[model samples]
Every structure is written in C-alpha cells, then in structure tokens.
Target: MNDSGAVLPWLVIRQDDNGNRYRVGRYATRAEAQKMADSLDARGHKQLYWVERIGQSVQ
Candidate 1:
C-alpha cells in the first residue's frame, strides 16, 4: 500500500499518437517505463503516455 493505504503504481501510461490513448499500471516509478521502452519486446516504437497517479487506483 502507498502512503494513503492504496495499492497503486508509481506511474501511468499514455500513447503519443493521434488517438492520445492512456493506460495505467502498478509500476514502481516512471523510470520503469523508460526501462520497458529501452528493452521493449515489440517490433514497433515504444510510445507511451506517463502520468502520476491521483485519487484511488484504477484497474
């Protein structure tokens, strides 16, 4: 649990395309996304939206 006693990740994701999509995960920090992007398993680009969590955690 975090300081607020909520099970939430450190950062979220957002796709930087025409759609401007978004996603959330239980990551420990924003750097984790960087690491995931650096070592991505996909063939395309690692474009993702990142944001700090607020309020209650989402699934």
Candidate 2:
C-alpha cells in the first residue's frame, strides 16, 4: 500500500503508436511498477511504457 493507504497504487501503463492506452498492471510500490514498465520498454517495441500513481484510494 502507498502512503495514501491505497492498495496497489502504482500502475504500469502501455501506449501504442496509435495513441491507445492500456493498463499493464498494478503494484504496491512505485519501484515495482517502474520495473515492469522498464522491462517492457527494453523489448524495443513500438509501444511506450510508463508508470503512474492512482490519485484516490478506495475505502
């Protein structure tokens, strides 16, 4: 959970050349989510990968 008490608050996102975005996965920590995004980016695919934090935690 993040400091905001959100579970799996980090999200790995993938965006293709067509500008379509997809949610790759969610993680408890930003590092974990960034790892997944970096790993995917290393593949050298046309798609772009990145991470973002969830703005609100579900109660």
Candidate 3:
C-alpha cells in the first residue's frame, strides 16, 4: 500500500539499450510481477531487468 491507500502489485523494468526504467504494470501480487520480470529476462526481452514493490525507492 501507498500513502494513497491504493492496493495493487507493481514492478520495475528497464530497457537494455537505453538503461531507462519504467513500470511494467500492476498485478495481483508481487510474486506475479516478479515472475513476469524473470520471464522477460529469460526470453531476452530486456538485458537489464528488475522487479520491486510499488512506492519503493530504488537507488
């Protein structure tokens, strides 16, 4: 949950070429989003991939 109290799953993704990060989409749970991220990595959709909870700050 966030300050707004909205409940949803979220994940972070980045493009391999440009190193730009963006939100993949909302899912039912964190695990599902992580699975998607892993799938992307496995399939070579993205060279650099990451998955994290919504509202989380990445450094």
Candidate 4:
C-alpha cells in the first residue's frame, strides 16, 4: 500500500525453465519492473515472464 489506500500492484518475474517463480521485487511502476526483468535477462536468464499483481490474484 502507498499513500493511497488502494493495494499497490507488484511486478513479478518467473523462471520458465523449471516452473519456479521468484519475486524480483515489488514496484509501484511497471517501468521499474521491466528494468528488473531486463537486468535478469541480460544476466542470461532468458526464460522469464513479467506479470502484474491484481486483487485476489493467484499465481
């Protein structure tokens, strides 16, 4: 949650190769999330997906 009462969404990255997912970190902006994903991709983790967190959302 931020200064507003609404729940803030998260930017998540998952490793597609092994069906394992990990939270790179939480961000209030999509750009921050993309940046993190790109950083991971540059590090050779190409099999990754970026997703947003929604209300009552399930992985």
Better of 1 and 4 by TM-score: 4
Better of 1 and 3 by lDDT: 3
RMSD of 2: 6.2
- For candidate 3, the per-residue lDDT at 40 reads 77
| Candidate 3 or 2, higher TM-score | 2
- Per-residue alpha-carbon lDDT of candidate 3 for residues 1-59, written as tens digits (9 for 90 to 100): 66678777676566557766667666657788888878778885537777777677578
Sort the predicted structures by lDDT, highest score first: 2, 3, 4, 1
Q: What tens digits encode model 1's per-residue C-alpha lDDT throughout 1-59?
A: 86778655555555665756566455665577555544542446656444555454434
Error of 3 at 6 (Å): 7.9
Which segments of candidate 2 are over 4 A away from where they belong?
1-6, 56-59
Sort by TM-score, top down from the best: 2, 3, 4, 1
TM-score of each: 0.37, 0.80, 0.65, 0.60
Best by TM-score: 2
| Candidate 2: 10-residue stretch with minimal lDDT | 50-59
Report clash pairs, candidate 2.
Answer: none
Clash pairs (backbone) in predicted model 4: none
- Every candidate's lDDT: 0.55, 0.85, 0.71, 0.67
- Candidate 4: list runs displaced more than 4 Å: 2-8, 56-59
The candidate with the higher TM-score, 3 or 4, is 3
Model 3, 57: alpha-carbon shift in Å?
A: 2.1
